[model samples]
Target: MMPLDNRRLLRSIVKLTEKPDVRAFELALLATLTEIVSAKTIRLCKIHESAKPPSQKVVVDVRVSDEEPLGDDASLPTLLIDDAAFLECLAKEEKVVASIGLGPGVRIVHPVKAESKMVGFLVIECEADIPRDQELVSIMLGFYKNYVSLLTHTQRDKLTGLLNGTTFDDKLLKIITAQRVGKMRASDGKGLYYLAMLDIDHFKAVNDKFGHLYGDEVLLLFGRVMVDTFRDSDLLFRVGGEEFVVVLRDVDLAQAVAILDRFRLAIERYPFPQIGKLTTSIGATIISGEDLPASIIDRADKALYYGKNNGRNQLWIYENLIAEGKLKVAKDDSSVELF
Candidate 1:
């Protein structure tokens, strides 16, 4: 049988794999690490490398003080930028250990790779030199990296790299719960969730004419456009060929319309490798807390189909269509007629 210390250590490492979400994993990582290393502060920093000077969002941070933790930090400035070490770490493809300015605390930043890409950094702050526990930190992070790759493999679409259909239901449930809580938004008098369902206009024709090679390429490029267009907070998913879903987080009707239409326009103007250009039709609706996933999907589908039926490349919001008397939905619940 394994010894008591060995068992406890193994259990801590195994705890890392239990979390299915990348976000929750951040907090879990720090919590588990703190058990072993007596650090002053450790941060799981996610770098938005796409932005100028690169914005940093500390997903999880621990500090030995009675001060506020870094929430949404401001974008790094040109003159006071801290991108050098992160960039250097990413460039050199290795850990960059440094000493805190005029302090005994040692800072260690390691590259976090997931699905064969450098996603972010794991920063450790400790009293003693970090090299002493470098090997242990490396091993723990190796487990983290592998689990992330596996998680993404299960969640992402094979062709597009957008989220696969299997994970949408779980995400939808969480969205409903978050909306129901309505903590920050409740007081602010703003922020609502919108779900958009879209389809590639005449995607069958593209596949029919160009064959699956370019069809696959188009799907791949479509995913790239979504990544470029949507904020990191927004959820993007490919629910099978030509059919996609987007959950626009915390936006008003106007913002939802603007962004959805912008995405449609972007898709319409995107130049395909051999196909020249392509367009998409979108259907969307405001998500209500009481609405079930099936009901929300139904509303979005009605809005989406109306667009395809009318033209082929447009955005339609379900509530707007109903308000305009252009469409009607059944009151299956038999409470009060919503239409």
Candidate 2:
């Protein structure tokens, strides 16, 4: 964060207010931070940790630079994360403005948190360290933090913190438009995206046997597994009950199948408290730009039900099953409006 001018600040607040969802909100925040800084470049770096973040490298989620933008892999943190900077930032209480001396000038480190847990750092470097920069950073980020909490609360399910069903249609529509699914396999971008429906096998039994507390724990742990297993770009939602959705960004059919099955295996291996072990059945299909949200969900749901009908804990793909004659291409305007 940097010194926020009144007019620039007003515009930043307005821009942030206009974003429809978190992804757009993030990019907008990046743009705002960049605009106010008056620097040659600025980036909104996000740390996506694995099971553990301590040893892992940070992911620069978005950037604005003087040169060509950071390509996906090219955006890996050149920030002095290995030394004290990143760890110190993460450790500090939120709103406690701190700076690590690195890269051309003093870089201000502001910890961004969600639900009291540190999510990432907001790093901005300005050549001239103004007297009130830290106070401004604290004020700017404090507003950001509080609004982020409110927006997150609205967007995510109270139980799982996965995007709620209300967000599904908007999210699905965004991806469908971005990929332009049916008309063309978009260039440079993976032409098609995979949408998968996941259900916990006999989840009702878990609740019945262990009670809702344990069942809720299982769902939470399951949500964590989904987070750890998928890329940040992928969209995840808890549509209803034990059912969930994962939109695999820009991956092909084979990769989608492998990834979904890998998650199934991960669930199977997990020891769920008194429940001991649990598994998930997954069904998925390639998204088509021409398809309605209902139609796309219907395809994935069909595959999911097919897997449930065949076996309790397995993964199935719509096209693969259709090719094998285990499933049929949907006809007769058969579509499920899940959300």
When summed lDDT is taken over every stretch of 10 residues in candidate 2, the lowest stretch is: 62-71
Worst 10 residues of 1 by lDDT: 61-70
Model 1: residues with Cα > 4 Å off, grouped in runs: 1-5, 47-82, 98-104, 183-189, 331-339
What TM-score, over all chains together, does every model reach? Answer: 0.84, 0.82
RMSD in angstroms, all models? 5.2, 5.0
Q: Tell me the spans in candidate 2 whose CA falls farther than 4 Å from its real position.
A: 1-15, 63-73, 76-84, 92-106, 181-191, 330-339
Local accuracy of candidate 1 as per-residue lDDT tens digits, 281-336: 99998777677888899889888888898888989998899888888655664221
Residue 303, candidate 1: alpha-carbon lDDT: 88
Per-residue lDDT of model 2, residues 13-76, tens digit only: 8879787665577777777666555544444566664575564644454542211212456564
In model 1, how large is the Cα lDDT of residue 162?
80
How far is 22's C-alpha from truth in model 1 (Å)?
Answer: 3.7
The per-model lDDT (C-alpha) reads 0.74, 0.72
